[model samples]
Target chain A: MDKNMVTNARELTNTEFFYGHKACAGCGGSLAVRLALKVLGQNSFVSLPPNCMSAVGFLFPQISFVTNAIIAPFAANAAVLSGIEAGAKALGLKDHHVVGFAGDGGTADIGIQALSGAIDRGDRIIYICYDNEAYMNTGIQQSGLTPYGARTTTSPAGKNLPGSIKMKKNMFEIVAAHGISYAATASIGYPEDYLKKVSKAAQCESTSYIHVMAPCCTGWGFPGERTIEIAKEAVDCGLWFLAEYENEKFTLNRKPSSFSPVKEYLMKQGRFRHLGDDDISIIERHRDHKWEKMLKNWDS
Target chain B: MDRPKVVKYKEPERAEDYPVGATFKAGHLVQTNSGWRTFRPIIDQDKCIKCLRCFLVCPDGAIDKSGESLEIDYDFCKGCGVCAHECKVGAIRMVKEGADEDGR
Candidate 1:
């Protein structure tokens, strides 16, 4: 009933999302889908938009899911999931978990309207945005979610200009502003913590939104094997922070004893390789400033 | 000039499929396969602590428990090595696809 909450051991039962599809060998978004489905289980129905995940994870003659799933429009993932939740209720269904699983581009940029509407209307769904920095599915295009100083095909670093001049959009705060029952920032590196949060969201009455940092090896120009490693490093260096909001309360899940240098995090990805000392200092200051702001908002 | 003949056939007399309107099937499997992997994961029973982390972390969802052991479905595993990479006990090893008889 409660997805058989695993206590001391990881359950041996199979998950809803399985292999067979055409995700890249080192794809992080696919990995995130697998973990999310593991917690949501077969009773959940996920909405995949026109992201890298929809392209590789689900397509024509071949599909990867073992449970129920639907492919939605790029900007209509949240909209479609809202309808599914409404329909599920109308059918006198019980225990149906409708989830909108979209990419950074879909969630923060294209699909924000439907996402915001669904959250505002208080739909019972868990909207998770697996952010891989850029629109990686379409040949590394720059999206609003792409972090500053990162290179995308649309915002390539050239002679005079550095990569993305604008900083990343803060969507978690935006979701929290909606007075959502559950909103959090999670990373692929923290599976236990991430799973716990998703499960908690499942039990909540209001909509839940989790923005997860999913490192992309191909888009980030790193070896596929370093996907989780980079995700962990991002949080360790304060490049990304893990925190949650419930009932208007805030708590930081991770606050490193001593923050790792931002250079270690930036240097690992080719997207930020062209950054010089001045750019690095700017990024370092940005991270510290963001962390200070989060500290102030902590416990609010 | 030979033109194909349009023969009247039985209209496939079955409930052709509509997701919602009034006809909808509750559940079905969507597991298509592409296991073109050169290497596959093999969990050694001796070393496994039954932590189930491999099954939990496999991107392909190819790992399953067999009795007190775990197994990987090479037919669907894409050789991502994520299971092996995440295994803390080193119980899972990625072996060459055809190395079963080579005794490596």
Candidate 2:
């Protein structure tokens, strides 16, 4: 581990590696990309799929990444990252990192196969999934990572059915299960922790993954400025968590002594505005069940 | 394949003036996003603690902290108010765009 890791906002690089893109106001995905790029420095090669980051980043005649970056196919973000790593190695490049920033839909749903393949091959690359909980760029569609009670365009809240019945996929654990060199769950709300994870991923010799929960203001139905606040609340309320996997071990980071009210967290979002008490309880129950298993199996 | 060049933004007089491929220079500020902003964040230097919280939280990378005091680049800032919202010391305030300098 780097002794002088950047643990504070003051220690972050002053350079703006990501800028002038057309991301929506307070877009959490863009913040994740910007912060990660700052940590990776100018030598990094970024691969983004057809997610919000790419849509708003790679606009014609206005590329956002200062470093070498490309738009990979929807399901090929990790694959492109592997190729970039191989090319960099072939060219004898040093002090460079190949990284991919995919959205939740791209990671947990579409790009899982290629990501798994990259891990299986032990490719030296960093895969970051900035999960805003759905296919936010494509008009708020239901995705594999969408929470059970969140409403979306496809999963409409009606008189009978709750929004989405499927819980968010355990992407961090899924990647860790492949025996990855490093894997962590983060949130844009916790910038220091997220920055440290990116720095760690850059230092890893083999496949590394970080799944960051980024709140989508437009899609999630919250004030744009409240994105970071809501993201923090999610972790504090036990809906999202911060953890890391390494050396065949799982470590829980920042375990809350007692979770804040999950209803308060969910009610702030427009997508959950229609969620009834029963739905909230179901979500809370699921969270408690997951935490019980995590506390028993992981090191806190 | 040619080495990518830093092509500056210019109005194309003819179709031939366009770049050869679907490519652009990295990190080029091709366009300013000030038009999208409805409100702008003004930093109160007296109250600012230099915590760099606003700089780190600005999604657009519009906050400039290279100087002695933080500055917001109005050209690219979308006026989302995240900086003002995140500032813990009550150093930043969101003012309506096009308002008087005194925040009338």
Per-model TM values vs. the true structure: 0.87, 0.96
**lDDT of candidate 1 over A1-300, digit per residue (tens):** 466453212652353454455777667788778777767777888787898776775543344565677779888999899999999899989987898789999999999999999999999999999999899888899998898889999898988778998888989998888998899999887767777777777787879999998888889988665677788888998889899998788889888888888887899999999999888888888888988888897962
Model 2: how far residue B42 lies from native, Å: 0.5
For residues B6-102, what per-residue lDDT tens digits would candidate 1 score against the true structure?
1232333456632334222222224433345766777777888878776665555667655446766655667777777778899777788767823
Q: Model 2: per-residue lDDT, tens digit, A1-300?
A: 576477778888778888888888989999999999988888889999999999987877788788888999999999999999999999999999899999999999999999999999999999999999999998999999999988999999898889998898888889999999999999999999999988888889999999999999999999999988999999999999999999999999989999999999998999999988999999999999999999999999
Name every residue pair that clashes in candidate 2.
none
Using lDDT, give the best candidate's number. 2
Error of 2 at B90 (Å): 0.5
Question: How much is A18 displaced in model 1, in angstroms?
Answer: 4.0
Off by over 4 Å in 1: A1-12, B1-35, B97-104
Return the top candidate by DockQ. Answer: 2
List per-prediction Cα lDDT, in the order shown: 0.77, 0.90
Q: Lowest-scoring 10 consecutive residues by lDDT in candidate 2 chain A? A: A1-10
Q: What are the per-model numbers of colliding residue pairs?
A: 0, 0
Candidate 1 chain B: worst 10 consecutive residues by lDDT?
B1-10
